[model samples]
Target: MTMTFIIVYVVIALILVGLVNLFMSKRKRKMKTQRTEQTLSENDTSHQSYQSKFNIRDTDETSEANDANAISEENGKLNISNNSDETEALTSDQNAVTQHEESHTQEEEINEKLKQKHSAFMFGKGTSQGKVLIAMIFGMFIAILNQTLLNVALPKINTDFNISANTGQWLMTGFMLVNGILIPISAFLFNKYSYRKLFLVAMTLFTLGSLVCGISGSFTIMMVGRVLQAIGAGILMPLGTNVFMTIFPPEKRGAAMGTLGIAMILAPAIGPTLSGYIVENYHWNIMFYGMFIIGLISLAIAYIWFRVYQVTTNPKADIPGIIFSTIGFGSLLYGFSEAGNNSWTAPSVVITLLLGVVFIVAFVIRELTMRVPMLNLEVLKYSGFTLTTIINMIVTMSLFGGMILLPLYLQNLRGFTPLQSGLLLLPGALIMGFMGPIAGRLLDTIGIKPLALIGTGIMTYATWELTKLNMNTTYSHLMVIYIIRSFGMSFIMMPIMTAGMNSLPQRLISHGNALSNTLRQLAGSIGTALLVTVMSTQTTQYVSTYSQDLDKTNPFIKDRLQEMAQAMGGEQMATQKILEFVQKLASINGVNSAFLVATALSALAFILSLFLRGKEHYISKE
Candidate 1:
C-alpha cells in the first residue's frame, strides 16, 4: 500500500479509538457517580441508626430520672421511711448508667465494623486483576518496542532524507533525551493523578504520535513525533512498575515483577528484527502504523480493564530541580551528539559539556537539600546501589554502542540489506529474552556475584571478538558472538539490579530503580553519540591518510590508477571510482576502530564486575 493510504488508515483507526474511549470514559464516570451516591446513602443510613439509638437512650434516661424523683417526692410527702424503695432507685440508676455505657460501646463497635467493611468494599480485591495486569503489560510492551524499532531503519532514513549520520543519530539520541527528562517527572505525575488517568493520557499521546510519524514527510516532523512518543513512553515505563507495586503484595511481587521484566526485555529484543523485516519489505511507515494499531487496542483494553489501585495525593513538583535536571541531561546529550558532527575541541562541544557537568552537580546539591527531591539522589548512599549503578551504566554504554554501530557496520561496510542485518541479530535478541527470566531464577537460587562474574566474562570475550570485525567476517560468526554476548547481558542486568535493590531499605527501592533507569537512558544516548563521533573522526583521519598517500610518487599506486582509468573508459570515471573505494575502505577501518574502543569499555565493565559482593552482603542490609 502507498504511504498516504496507510497514514490515512491509521488516522481513521486512531479517531475511532479516541471516540470509543471518550464514550467509555463518560459511561465510566456516570457509573462512578452512581456508585458514590449509593455509598453515601449507605453511610447516611448507618449514621441515622446511630443517632436514633442515642436519642432513644437519652429519652429512656430522662423518663427514669423523672420517675426516681417522683418516687422520692412522694416518699418525703408521706413521711414514710422506705429503705427498700431508696435502694431500688439507686440500683435502677446504676442499671441505667450501665445500659447507656453498653449501648455506646456497641455503637462504636458497629461503626468500626462498618468502616472496615466500607474500606474493603472500596478497595476490593479485583476479580479481573490478572486481566488488568495483562492489559498494562501489553501497553508497556508496545511503548517500549517503539523505542528501538527504528534503530535499524536509521541509516535508511538518513539516505532517504539526505541527512548526515550525525543528524540521523538524533533519532536515537533525541528519543533518549526526551525519556531522560520525562522519567523523573513520573513520580510527580503518579502522585498528582490517578493511575488510570495517567495511563489514558500516555496511551493517547503515543497513538497520536504514531499517527504523526506514519504521515510525516520530513525529518523535523518525524522528530516531533518521536518526542511526543517518548513522553508517553517515559510515563508508561514507570507507571507499569508503580502499578505492579501497588497491585501485588510483597509475597507475590517477585513473580509479577518477573513478568514485567519479560515485557521490558522482550520488546527491545524483537524490535530490530521486526523493524528490519518491515523496512526491508515494506515502507518504514508501516512500523508506525503497526504500533498505532497495537496502541489503539491496548487503549481499548485499558478502558475496559484498567483500574486505579492506589490513592493519589497532590504533590508539588520540584520546579528548580526539574529545570536543572533538564539543562544537565539535555546539554550533555547535545554536547555528545554535536561532537559527532563537530570536533571534540569545538567550542560548542566544550561549553555544553562543561555546562552539563555544572548543572548536574547543582542538581545533585538541590536534590540533597530539598524536602522532596525529584530524583531522590540519596539512594546512592547505599554502597551496593552505587556499585551496581556504576556497573549498569558501563554495561548500558557498551550495549548501546554495539546496537548503533553494528547496524552501520553491517549495512554500510558489509553491504547487508536492512532485513539481512536485522536477521543477523534475531537469534541473539531471542536468546537474551529467553535468558532474562532464567537469570532472575538464578539470582534467586544462587546470587549476583557468580552470575556477574560469568556474565561479564562472556560479555568481555564477545566484545573483544567484535573488535576484530572486518569485510571478510562471516554472518554466522557474528551471530554466534552476539548470541553469547546477549546471553551474558541477560545474566548481568537483572541480577545486579535485583541485588542492589535488595540492599536498599524498602522506602528507597523505588528511588533506586528510578536512578538506575535514568542512568541507563543517559548511558545509551552518550554511548551512541560518543561511538558515532569516534567512528566519524576515525573515518576522516583514514581518508586523509589515504588521500595524502595517493598524492605521493608511488609507482604501484600509479600503475593501479592507470589501469583503473583505462578500464573505466576515461580518467574522470576512474577518479570517481578511486574516491568511492577510498571512502568505503576508510569507513570499514573506522568502524573497526570504534569496535576496538567498545572492547576497551567492555573490559572496564568486566573489571568492575569483579568487585561485586555476594548477595549475603546486600541482603544483610535489608
Candidate 2:
C-alpha cells in the first residue's frame, strides 16, 4: 500500500512538472512572436527606403552603360532628330534591353529577400527562439535525468534478476558505451536533418525505451530498453548544446549555457537521491514508469513547439572515421568501467585499453587527412579551446571520483542506508542547481578567470577537508563540505565550457560541442575507475597489515578484541566481531587514501585554472 502511494506521488509530480513546462513554453512563444512582429513593423519604412535608394543607384549605372554603347554604335554621326526611322529603331532597342535587365535584377532581389526570410525563420532570428530553447532544455532534462536515475536501483535489479555484480553493471556500461558511439555522429545528424525532425526522433526513442524498461519481464528485455534509451540520450545532450550555441552569440553564451547547466548538472545531481527514495519505498520498475510518463510528455511538448533553429546541410558520413571512433572511444570507456570491477592488470583491461589508444591515434590521423571529418580535429588549432578542454577533462575526473567514492564510504564503512546516503548528498545538488544561472550571469559580466580561480580554490579546500573524514565523522559535517564543493563546481563547469566554446568559429560550433561532451563522458569513466582501483588496492594492503598486527599477541590488541567480543555478548562472537571491526577500519583508511588522490586532482585543476585566459582575450581574437 505504501509502495502504491509513492508511485502515485511520483507520477503526480512528473505530470505537474510537464504541464508547467508546456504552459510556460507556449506563453513565451506567444510573447516573442508578438515582439518580433512589432519590431519588424517599426523598421518597415526605413527598410523600404534603403532598398529604393539601392535600386536607383543600380538604374543610374545601367543607363550610363547603355548611353555609352549607343555613342559607340553611332560612330561620331550625331543623330539629334527625334522622328528618324534609324533613331526610332535605336531607341526601341535600348528600351527593350533596359526592360530585360530591370526584370532580371528585380527577380534576383526577390529571391535573395526570400532566402533571408527563410533563414531568419529557421534560426528563430526574431521569433520564439527562447521557446525552442526551453523545450529542448526540458527534453534534455528528461534524458539526462534518466542517465543516473537507475544507479541506486541497480542493487535491487540484481537481487530481483539473480545476476552477478559484473553482469548487472552492464546496465550502466551499456548505456555509456552506446552514448560514446552515438555522440560523435550527432554533428553529422545536426547538419543533415532539421532540428525539429532530430528532436522528435530523439524523444520518440526515449519514450519508447522508457516504456520498454517499465514493462520488461526479463533482464535481456531490460538491457534492450537501456540501449534504446542511450541512443536517445546521446543525441539530446549535444543537440541541445548545439541549439543553445546557435541561438546565442558568444558574448551572451555564458549566461545561456549556464541556464543549460541547470538541466545538465541538476538532473544527475538529483537522480541518485530521487532514485534512492523511490527504490527504497517501492519497486525498481516504478522508477521507469515515472520516466516513461515524463518522457511521453516531453516528446509531446517537443513535437508541438520545437522549431527548426538551424539550417540543414548535405554532409555525407565518413564511414572510416565512424569505425575508428567506435573502436577508439567505445573500447576506452569499456576498459575504464571494467577496471573498477576487474583488476587493471587483467588481460581484458590491458588489451582493451591498448586497443583504444591505438585506434584513437589512428582516428586522429584519419580525421586530419579527410576532406570532411566525422569529428572536426581542426578546432584544436585554437589554443584557448585546447586549454579549456584539458581543464574540463581534469575537473570532470575529479568530480566523478568524489561522486563514486563518497557513496562507498557512507554506505560500506559507515553503514548508512542507500536512501540515507542519497539524502545526505541532496542538499549539495540543490545548491549547485540554484547557483548555475547566477554563476552564468557572473561569467557574462565579470569574466571566467576570477570566478574559476575562486571556485577552484573553494573546491580544492573542500576536497582536502574530505580527506580528513574518519569513522566518527558526523553526517552534518560531510553535508557541509559537499555543499561547498557543489558551490565551487557551479562556477567552474559551465563558465569554463562556455569560455572554451566561445573561442571557436560559428561554423565549428556543432563539432566543438560534440567533442567537449564526448571527452567529458570519457573523463568521468576514467576518473571513477582510477580512484576505485586505488581504493581497492589500498584497502587490501591496510587489511593485510592490520591482520598481521592482530596476530602479534600484543596486550592492547588482545584487550580491544576482547572488548568487542563482550559487546557482542560472548567470547564465541569475538573473532567474527573483531575481524568485522578491523575490516571497517581498513575500509575507512582506504577511502581516506583515495580522497587524498582526489585532493591532488582538485589541486591540479586549480593550478590549471590560473592559466585560463579571460573572456576578453577570446572576444578580442574574434
> How do the predictions measure up, each by TM-score?
0.75, 0.83
Give the per-residue lDDT of model 1 (tens digit) for 1-622: 1223223422433343345346545555665666568768988999898889789889988987897789778888999887887788789889988988998889889888876554331223453668767888899999999987987788788888888876777677667666766676566566555678778888988998898888988898887788678778877888787676556544344355556676787787688888988877888899998989999999998887786544334446576776777767767766776676567898877887898899889988998998887677778888888998888888888888888888888887888877788788878877866776677667766767888888888888888888787678999999999999988888886667666666666556556767777777778767877788878889999999999988626888878878988998987898889898899889988887887787777788889878887666666344
Best by TM-score: 2
Local distance difference test scores for all models:
0.76, 0.80
Candidate 2 lDDT tens digits, 8-72: 32243234324433543554466556656765774575467656866886687578768867865
Kindly report which residue stretches of model 1 are placed more than 4 angstroms away from their true locations once superposed.
1-133, 151-174, 215-224, 245-258, 544-552, 559-566, 570-579, 619-622
Q: Name the lDDT value of residue 522 in candidate 2.
A: 94
446 in model 1: Cα distance from truth in Å? 1.4
Q: What are the RMSDs of all candidates, in order? A: 8.6, 9.4
What global local distance difference test value does model 2 have?
A: 0.80
